[model samples]
Target: MADELKRRAVHASGAGLVALYLLAAQFDLGLTWDRFQLLMGLLAVGTIALEFLRLYVGLELSLYDSLTREYEQNQFAGYGYYMLSMTVAVLFFEPRVALPAMLMLAIGDPISGTVSDDSLKFVKGPRVLVTMFVVSALIAAPFLHETPLAVVAAAIGATVADGVKLRIGDYIVDDNLTIPIYAGLLATLVLEFGPV
Candidate 1:
């Protein structure tokens, strides 16, 4: 439980990136969207490099033992996927869709993780799914209030991403990669097509 709590703590810390992005934008701190996207892209590249070193070059880091799950030992860790997803969201989606989508992964996923039973494997329980949806909806509401349909769509996307564990061959698709991407795509669709 202590270890899980520590993981959750680190998971929740991803929210700081969103906060920093928002604050920088609001205050005109010189971190524009293009710059932010570039930074995220660099981070994604760095993580990929690290994963390559760890998986193929036989580089071992102590932090991996502590921060990564058993399933991640032989594969890319969640942090890499998290960075990749955030980069994808920011680069491909508008701020209105991307910000809340990032928040859904950063804030909503950690909260859902806290209530989830990892031992269940593959899929989280119904309660965890509901919690994910509600939290994701709340996180998105202030940003997407004018488009209620977008908000709901984002929530549903995040919930589905968080609740299901999809596998392709030997690799399990991490929610860290899916959550923001799914949320952003759904929200963008709603904003584009849903009634104003």
Candidate 2:
């Protein structure tokens, strides 16, 4: 439980990182969308390079836990999945969509995890669902232009994505990858099709 909480704490810290999207959205950062994509691309590449080095060269970093330390064996370490998903979300969605989508995962997932007593049913229980939706809606309201519909969709999507523990052969899909991508796509769809 302590390890899970520690991981969730690290996960929640991504909210601060997602806040930077606001600067780009408002054009305060002087970053064009293309430049933003380039930057994210660079960051993704750098992350992969470092991971490769760490896995192949036995670069032992104290920051990463045994989960990532065993990256040579585990192709999809949590941090790698995190960077990959974040980069994909940024590149795939517009800033408006990406910001709230990322926030849903960043803020809501940890909250859901923290509140759930049962690890197996974490985001699946009814109480956790309500809490996830309310917390996600509140956090996303200020940022999402299509507040009501998009927030609701994002909240639900993030919850579902977080609940998923899909495995493909040896690798398990991380929620860090699932949450933002799933929520972002759902939010985008809702914003496009659902009534405001």
Candidate 3:
């Protein structure tokens, strides 16, 4: 029970980053995409280095226990995947696409996770998917040009990607990586090519 609460707190903290980005944009804090990319890159590198140490040098950390699962014992934690994907998204896409993508990844992923927990009294599966889609769409609406279609496609794509845990041989692909890349790609493609 304590672990579940800690996990939720961590998820909420990650979701809070969406607000920081929004506030920076609103307050005109000069938070450009380039700077954001730099930030994410640094974080990604740091996470990778720490994970290496944790695996090789016997770096036993309590925080990691709260954040990671047995699947991540010899792999990068979700936070690493999150930073890496965010950096890639910022680097490959323009601000308009990347911003909404980040918002969906930051906000939508946490919402889906928090509500999907079985111990929370909610037992319906479709309800979780619907809630995830609706929340993602709302998050993307403010930034997406074709708000309805683009946001809907992004929401569906992200939710689907998040639901499926992929594996390449022995390496499990975390949703942290899939969520932003899939969501950003779908949103960008729909905005660029679908239904002008």
Candidate 4:
């Protein structure tokens, strides 16, 4: 339980990036969207470099033992995928679409994790899926209120990402990577083509 809490804490810390992105803009800190995307890209690059060192160069860090799951020992960790997804979100989507998606990963995922059972399976339980949908919808509401359909779609996308574990050959796709991208893509599609 303590370890789970620690993992969730680290997961929730991703919200700090959202806070910084919003606060910097509100306070005129000159961290514009382009600059923020660049920053995320740099983070993704750094994460990839670290993952290469860990996977190929046989580098071992204590942080990995504490935070990563057993399955992640040989592959890229969730944090790497997380940074990559976040960078892709900001770079490809508008703020109205991206911010809510990011929040769904940062806040909604942690909440879902807390409510989930400790099963190392491919799919979460129905209760956890419901919780993820509700939380993700609420998180996206304020940002996507003008387009309620988009909000619903985003929530559904986020829920699906959290509920199911996708595998590409031997690698299990992390929700950390899928949640924001799915939500952002769904929201963007609705905003672009759906009736607002």
Q: Per-residue lDDT of 1-196 in model 1, one digit per residue for the tens?
A: 7766777777778788888889998898999988988888888899899899989999989767656887788878888888899899999998888988998998899899878776657878998999999999999999999999999999999999999888999767889999999999999999998888
CA-only RMSD, every prediction:
1.5, 3.1, 3.4, 1.5
Clashing pairs in 3: none
Mind giving the per-residue lDDT tens digits that candidate 3 earns over 1-196? 6776676566556555556666888899987656767876787788889888898888998989887866678766776777777777778877767766776677777778766755423233776778778887887788784557888887877777666667799665777887778888888888788887
Q: Distance (Å) between predicted and true CA of 79, model 4?
A: 1.4
Superposed model 3: Cα runs more than 4 Å off: 117-124
For each candidate in turn, the TM-score is: 0.93, 0.81, 0.84, 0.93
All candidates' lDDT scores?
0.89, 0.72, 0.74, 0.89
Task: List model 2 lDDT by residue over 68-187, tens digit each.
Answer: 524335464776777778788889987777777777777787787776765653236777777777876776677674467887787777777776566789666778788779878888
Pull out the clashing pairs in model 1: none
Instruction: Give the C-alpha lDDT of model 4.
Output: 0.89
Which rank order by lDDT, best down to worst?
Answer: 4, 1, 3, 2
Model 1 poorest ten-residue lDDT run: 62-71
TM-score of 1: 0.93
CA lDDT, candidate 4, residue 45: 93
In candidate 4 the C-alpha lDDT for residue 82 amounts to: 81
